[model samples]
Target chain A: MAGDGTGGGSQVVLVTGGYDHTIKLWQAHSGVCLRTMQHPDSQVNGLEISPNGQMVAACGYQHIRMYDLASANPDPVITFEGITKNVSRVGFQKNGSWMYTGGEDCTARIWDPRAPPQTRCQKIFQVQAPVNAVMLHPDQSQIMVGDQSGIIHMWDLKTDQNDQLVPEAEASIQDIAIDPAGKMMAAVNNKGNCYVWALGGQAHPVPRKHIAAHHKYALRCKFSRDSTMLVTTSGDCSAKVWRTSDWTPMRELRHETQRWVWDAAFSIDSRFLFTGSSDSYARLWDVERGTLEREYCGHQKAITALAFKDQAV
Target chain B: MEVRPPEKQKSLLAEQLENCPNLPHRQYLEYAKFDGTAQMGLPTKSFKIFMTMLPEKHQNYPLVVCVIANAKIKDLIGFTCYKYSIEHPEISLGSVHDYGLCIAEDDGEVDWAFPCLDSNEPCSKFGFTCLGLIELKYKTVCAAPIPMPEDGIAFHMFPKAADSGQSHQNTSRHNTGGSQTSEAVISAIRAVNEDKKKSGDVNLEKIQSHIMATEAPQYKVYKVYLLRKVRTNTPVQLGVSLDRIEVEPLVTHKHAFWQSRSKYFLHSIDSVAWCQVLETRGNRTTFRIIYSPSHNAAYSDKNISGNTSFFHPNSTYKVHDFECEHDMAKEIVEKVNTILDLRNSPCRREYKTAKEKKSQTRRSFHTKHLS
Candidate 1:
């Protein structure tokens, strides 16, 4: 397994973090652990790789830590603290100018990495309840923040206008995702339902359809880079791949001891899925065949959050 | 295993079975009840509700004559015959649990020695003695066999040893209660058959109708419910009719039979108070008949041989209450209401005709609204 961009055939970095309070970088294809970084204080809630592929940011209780992907440092290169509660998700802008994070503190914060540590938080978009997910639009102006109160707050950074939509009553929005084409956006709730909306304008979310994707709590939903498929992992212990064209199920990837699959990431080609589950192993599954391709087995506890990037460098 | 043939039916039973297609069932239905004119005006003291305790209680009563009615009665006659000769250990759970009326006796005799209360003077005055049981081989009452009630009063009649004179002589001498009791019922039926052969009066209905007309019991107990008195927690039969309420101790023991029932006329009842057992958490419906036993002699019925009082009938007011399971309580109320309608009253008939017309219109309006 190669390190990062400079010395790689195909730069593929898979980082998983969980309640064990450690971040593990695995060889996505060979199932080897190339590095383990200590998260130090709390369990990691979410993880995302920067668009430049040089850094990976992990959000946890009261902190968001960015680790240097090019170096062998076992500690976070920079730790941003003073967040009041557990941060749920972290993502970067398409140009990597800023970072966005949603947290149990009921706010989504925009942080500029170049700014001084004390003044890094550039903006705060507050909602009625703790935000569980935040997704950046392809245009990079509209930020969709899904919260515990079932409201999806679409905050347009360009005009500072906010719009809210509730997909279900009394169901907490667990995760939200937008296709790379920017045409479709889907949000999954704790009730195992996935709601799809046709995105025309920045805030106009037309209800498309409802799909019952799982029988239990759905944890994470992500769209393939090609915008052809969607993979949703759930507490039902299976990550399901559904074709976006007809919204039909393609396959269900399940392992004997998978337990609750907390997070999943799609391969760039959409042929495979990497799932982190409560069984302390991040599994690579062939999306079409629904077979176990490999198991990344070094985590001591649950591998709750994972970030994957496979790109030609 | 030896291959044996099915026992040959006596020629007379086969002939009767051939004559009457439903002879076995007819015999069962006809003979099972002893609540007819045959029981009327008789020494009711000599009668026991429990057929199994016949030998112990009504030893002097002519059990054979009354029991000649049907197959079930023939089985009861076996009970009386056993009274004449042998003691019974076989009279067990069936007779005791169902209170004699619904005896379910199996084929074999059972001899069990249980400790009896020898004396009440000492707490430990207990003695073990054998409960004697006699073996009975039931002969088919008819050639065309019939299915009887599943758990009703059914027992095998002792074999008559009709083919073997020697065995018949021994059965009568030792009187194992085997032959003598059944002989009377069989002979009477044979007499009926003999009369049928001569006169062509082959119908059993004629005989039954005659009995029903002439034999209304002292208390024509219409509907009987096996319930327990709420106040005393003792088992009782709440026999209800349109106007008569007979609360008798229904334990089926000699004492329960002798314990005079608390009788009341429904019209004399100030109020019939009953708890809604269907919704009660206790699963028991407490039914009470509160009666102010009127001093008026005009309403008294002269069926009882002498004056009988229940909960002091002479008292200004009395409440007779009993409790039963919810289903049984519902059944009792439903049956009582049905019997109340069975009473012939010209005034009530006219009122019911008018009420039906009103209800019919109400029902039609509701249906129209629902549609």
Candidate 2:
């Protein structure tokens, strides 16, 4: 993606990783594959670009690797090790002073990237089951963690306190997303239901509503930068966009060969959507017209995870 | 049975129409009257209304129009679309099984017709009945109600000759001779009433049996955007009847008014190498058919002249893509495959399941107005 602050002037940096154990960088507008970095040890479970857009942190089994985005190097500059199982998700704090990750090790950990490798672990929030997803509120004061047992643990950074709730009885939580405004939060589960929460300054986050977004397993949910649209991808080979006003479906992004859309991201403007599918292709679609604008080919296997940074730094 | 609009009093809409009386047929077809016979067009008001139903920006872009109709249900219905200011008559299709409308004859002969809305005017080529089961979007309810029949209804189109007195005489004679053969039982197709039994609903099963009774070939023409062109309009029509294959691009110039000429390729069932329907992320499904042209003698009578670039007529095979609702891709695939089976050509390359959307029908749109 041309907007990744990486190509020097806040150009997009689109990187996709999957079971194929390779990460690919793409020129978002032209559908061109820019670079391919190999993850020979294990498949990349998740990918996140630094807030500065100068580095991409890839989540893998027992390790998290950080690669330089400003240079052409294909090797990882730093590998955060000492994790016991598959690192399910990875993300950076707003200022890049620290990073947060959730893993099958049944814990969500905060790491200070500037610390020595042995003492990089800053704090850990342990749960009964594996953590599948974690999202930081835009205020950067709290982290929302979703686990395999359907429990969501809200960890407050400033107070060092935690609160937990179960949105469903048995359905595993797949992903969680907080809207850019920090006023609402959305979480998806294996049952294809999405639960939203209205966040208040000091009060408990109130349950807003639950949407039956898909008939099959829901994989991911993302809120647009403007906080007006919510997009959900599912194993049903579809990604649906919903208007935030009344939660009515806006458009469905689909291509004939596209199957099991695993990850999707809204461009900085929210007028275009980029999706990675199980068919080894990533596509750019016009959000308003619901038409395909471009297709990025060349992945050897399904692209299960993608990180896109298009904002100008 | 007599079924009419209950207590029909002309509404304000009728009075508005009366103030602007329709243009006479002679004045409407005047531009090309000297160049042999003229094609019948829609009344100016109806044409404007029809154009308004289409997308405003792409009004002049290439379009694929398809219609289906039956002869027994005779309310005069047809289409008129403009081509750079030169208006042209539209094609209406009919038939369920074989008899009502067939693209090719029982013997494999291809005779395409460009039908008209006016029953008095002679149609192009030889006379032919229209195919049944077309959407009634542009149907004009002004023509005299059709008097029903015994065996089946007769939707006859007069064809050939100039604006000579003899052509008119031949048409009325054909119309009367055609209607007299069947019993004079009136089965009206339009103007329904509150009484269910009194209102004439054109039974679909009966039309099916009527068509199957003839064992004839039937076809349909669809209006769509083909070849990504922005100017010339096209209608790719194909019909299935017997074990035969044919391809002809029929070009009919309604107004012989334009200085430049265009070529229209009519793709028959035989010319199609494959049929595919791939449902995209959206609610609509897309129909894709590969048309490979053959330089055979049967296609010579089709419309062709200058500016072949519109469709790239010289290309080996061109792909025509159009968005159709209602499981159209599956229907087209099955129909095309039946003929391909006869030819022993292996074509279906993708999983019909992968390409087809799970749902056969389009989902309803929830717009702001509905919300």
Candidate 3:
């Protein structure tokens, strides 16, 4: 499980299950555990926080669950279960009104977070291969889906239109992040390659730059708030920062334990970068100086997800 | 030298005078073209005459040789005089008046001075000399050198009449000295011209390319994190590892430009007086001991007031003062130093833990005993 900096009185964390079949919450700057919400029957595979930081959505074996951080544990306020196979990843709209789930069912489903329990799940689009990861565009009207075949499919919700799928990669697509300005999209493939593409053009989504981002599999990628920097975590046991201007590497963080870094996220101010690794530790880094400031090591297994919440209202 | 006959002299003079239509009869004459018209005029008080003397090879003919006059007298009087002489079959007075027209030569000899064939006394009240005479041959006037006035009762002749034999010597001298000087001047002019041509041919593009090719590429080595490791007597296998390497470009002041500005300040304090240290989130403080060899003083001199400390050869000092995890710092420094030492060592080597080394030694002893 990974903790996110929240915009509230307390920080919230979404935990994917390993030894513990639950997602937990903690205070942001202080490492005090706040809540523990258990999964019903299966391990939690993925978790995503809404841009507003009010809702946390988790996908598991056969269901996608959305939890309002303000509510108590044991049950999600809303749940969706239309996918036939285990859901691998989940994402939320920036406004917290909608949720998206990608799974082995080879389709990405969109759900209404405000709908009644009976009517929450809805099928949006189908892909050829199992969708491994999904991310909602910052605009909240479109969703980008990465599949097992490494192709990325963009679904426009408003017009019910599917953009042409981008091909030309050789591995599974693991993670995707859209720049804050919505001008570029960065995608990391399972083979450790990262490609940045330009947005809004008659020209095909040509990769603006390509980097052999990691020595091994790159599991996750995220852009900073100002969109000037990118942070990535890899199976190579390291995290890296890249400058967006020239796609040049800024720094690499390596650990002596050689833990598999599963996910990385930046704070809203982008002063801190947090990486969750297989060593059951979540380390906070001073991004500018590339120094590890603190390490939270409470989890028993790998921490597969991480996020930062803004201050609470 | 034999004198040329008078008949021949008259013919030469006639030839020399044939085309000269504006020869002034009484004062120095000058001709200049202005607005496409030749203006033959005379200066005041001064007089000029053109004369041609016949050579011995053509004594049967006479020609004019030279022109002479006092230019300063002409300027004073504002007009010049011109005169010509011609042989006539008449005698006027005494033996002096029996000769053809004569004028005194300016050479100041009395015997060669002759009275005018028409008037008995000196030709003019001002004692002016006839400028020269003309000699002719086949319609062309040839100049001959005039004789010295000491030759008694001599007729006025051109000055070049006496200089013809020496012309070959003058031409050879002129060729040697004048040509050498002219050649040197010409070569200097050529060198300057060639330099200008080469300067124009310089390719600025190629020069820029060469500069870029030869110039060293700049590198920025940021102090990402200082790893500190401190090992007790425990013989721990210390190794340092860098996790994230981030590089940010830092623009440093050019050494020459900074040094030039440094000259304006009397002391180091005054040099940085106007500059303030900026406090940024990750700003780092650096400490160095600066010593001036010329001043024979260290940065810790009493006159300099700051936190700066001087470094001495045999002295140890605690340099850095910052708060960090003590264990992590000690481990990092030790590991970094171990790596540095390994890299600096001449022999390529690796370290084995004490346990591993002990086990290996025991195994080797056992094998030797078995053998």
* Steric collisions counted per model: 1, 37, 73
| Candidate number with greatest TM-score | 2
TM-score of chain B of each: 0.24, 0.28, 0.13
lDDT for A182 (candidate 1) = 81
lDDT by residue (B1-371, candidate 2, tens digit) is: 11121221222222211221211121111111111101011111100112212223322222211111221212122222111112222111121111121232322222224222333333332233222222222223323322222221233321222232221111210121111111101111011111222323336753543333222233433333233457553443433432223322334566755733344444444345666675543555666667554422244345362333243444255565655444554555555554443222212111221123222122112222253
On TM-score, the stronger of 2 and 3 is: 2
**Using lDDT as the measure, what is the rank order of every candidate, best first?**
1, 2, 3
Interface CA RMSD, all predictions: 46.4, 29.5, 60.9
For model 1, how many clashes?
1
lDDT of each: 0.58, 0.56, 0.47
lDDT (Cα, tens digit) per residue for candidate 1, span B253-274: 6655555644323331112222
Residue-level lDDT of model 1, residues A40-157, one tens digit each, is 7788999998888888999999999998887755556667877989999999998899999999999999999876567889999999899999998887878999999999999999
Error of 1 at A158 (Å): 1.2
State residue A287's C-alpha deviation in candidate 2, in Å.
Answer: 0.7
10 residues in a row with least lDDT, candidate 2 chain A: A1-10
Candidate 1 chain A vs. true chain A: TM-score? 0.96
Q: TM-scores for all candidates?
A: 0.45, 0.46, 0.43
